[model samples]
Target: MDELIARVSAAIGVDAGVARTAIGHVLAFLRKELPDGPVAEFMNQMAGAHQAADEASAGGESAGGLLGGLLSGGLMGLATKLNALGLDMGQIQKLGHEVFGYAEGVLGKEKVREIANSVPGLSQFL
Candidate 1:
């Protein structure tokens, strides 16, 4: 995943370090924006939903379950909000993917997801 993120970031011509910081910010924003269902919730969601994904990959359940859950649960709300504001889920997903993809490229999505998901009161940011 680290290599993948780096590969993608390099393809996009962004400073890997800057991309990492941007990912940190995006993770923070996700927490702040979805205070009620922030990173912590995402962490649990990821942990809880691990089995539904493929087990053969090296990234394993935490990446699939925890990170995937966070994306589905937390970002789902974001999609709805954007839709309410005259954007569609596709646009929201695109914007989120761009933002998060950069971040993942920098720091690796799981790393950012783990740290961000551990904080308390992240929901307060919403």
Candidate 2:
């Protein structure tokens, strides 16, 4: 998890804290949008991911804004949530690539592809 956070931080040019929060938001969004099986597999494979997802689920800076209320599901909502964490679209895409790349290293390409494909409009991020 720390490796992933570091990679995202360095690659996205954000601090560790911001990268972590963004990761939490993305994981939480996936938990909400994906089926139980794939999400469970991902959570199990990724250490500390459950904690991050839980934190995001509990709500924080990203959940309270007016835009947060307006966007509730799918990729648009995920983008909105991430944007609240101070990432632009390019950074968001880079974050996704780094995260999915990390996931592929841990969980394999097929698993990551399955997870990404399950969500509509998510392929663009990959």
Candidate 3:
């Protein structure tokens, strides 16, 4: 995860610490946004969201449809984290772009797009 943070930082020319903090905020926000469930549950939610998008896009092209499940309900939590961290929306957006781009590089554009579309701030990258 730290390596992922570092790569994202490099990609977007942000400090590694900033990238790490931003991602930590995202994960923590996800945990808080989810119902009282295991971490695996959130992971499952993310995957299911992606698969749904893949299926929907098979017949026609779409932009953020693949991201719906991810961005469904976590925005407020993510915003709270950013507020606590003293990062404004622009910072959060920049971090999101870097992280999403790096994720895409690793998981392939489609898979990453699917994942990004599901998450809160990440959906903007779409």
Candidate 4:
């Protein structure tokens, strides 16, 4: 997890904290949008993933007033959340690529491809 965060931070030119929060947001989004079985497996494979997702979920709930309610689901919502973390669209795409690339390294290409394919409008990020 630290390795992944470092990669994202260096590659996307964000600090480690922002990269981590952005990862949390993306993980939280995936947990909500993706199928349970694959997501569960993915989470299991990644160290600190559940922690990140849990933190994101908790933060989202506490912070979820009007804007959170407005951008509550799907790809656009995920984009809005990442944007809130100070990432532009290009950074977000790079983040996604780094994350997916990391996932592929750990979980293999086929599994990662399956996970990516399962979500609508997610391929653009890849």
- Judged by TM-score, which candidate is best? 4
Tell me how far the alpha carbon of residue 9 in candidate 1 is from the true structure, in angstroms, after superposition.
17
TM-score-wise, the better of 1 and 3 is 3
lDDT of 2 by residue, 1-126 (tens): 899999999999999989988998888888888748766787788889989988876774446477786775678877888887889999999999998888788778788888888987787766
TM-score of each: 0.32, 0.91, 0.52, 0.91
Backbone clash total for model 2 is: 0
Model 3 residue 74 distance off true place after TM-score fit, in angstroms: 1.6
Candidates 3 and 4 compared: the better one by lDDT is 4
The worst-scoring run of ten residues by lDDT in candidate 2 lies at 57-66
lDDT of 4 by residue, 14-91 (tens): 999889888888888888887486667878888999899889777765455567669878887777777767789999
Q: Return whichever of 1 and 3 wins on lDDT.
A: 3
Model 3 alpha-carbon drift over 4 Å, by segment? 7-15, 30-73, 119-122
Q: Which stretches of candidate 1 lie over 4 Å from their true place?
A: 1-29, 33-76, 112-126
> Higher-TM-score candidate among 1 and 2?
2
lDDT of each: 0.40, 0.83, 0.51, 0.83
| Backbone atom clashes (below 3 Å) for every candidate | 5, 0, 5, 0
- What are the root-mean-square deviations of the candidates from the true structure over C-alphas? 15.6, 1.6, 12.7, 1.5
Instruction: Mark the 10 consecutive residues where model 4 has the least summed lDDT.
Output: 60-69
Question: Which run of 10 residues does model 1 get worst, by summed lDDT?
Answer: 48-57
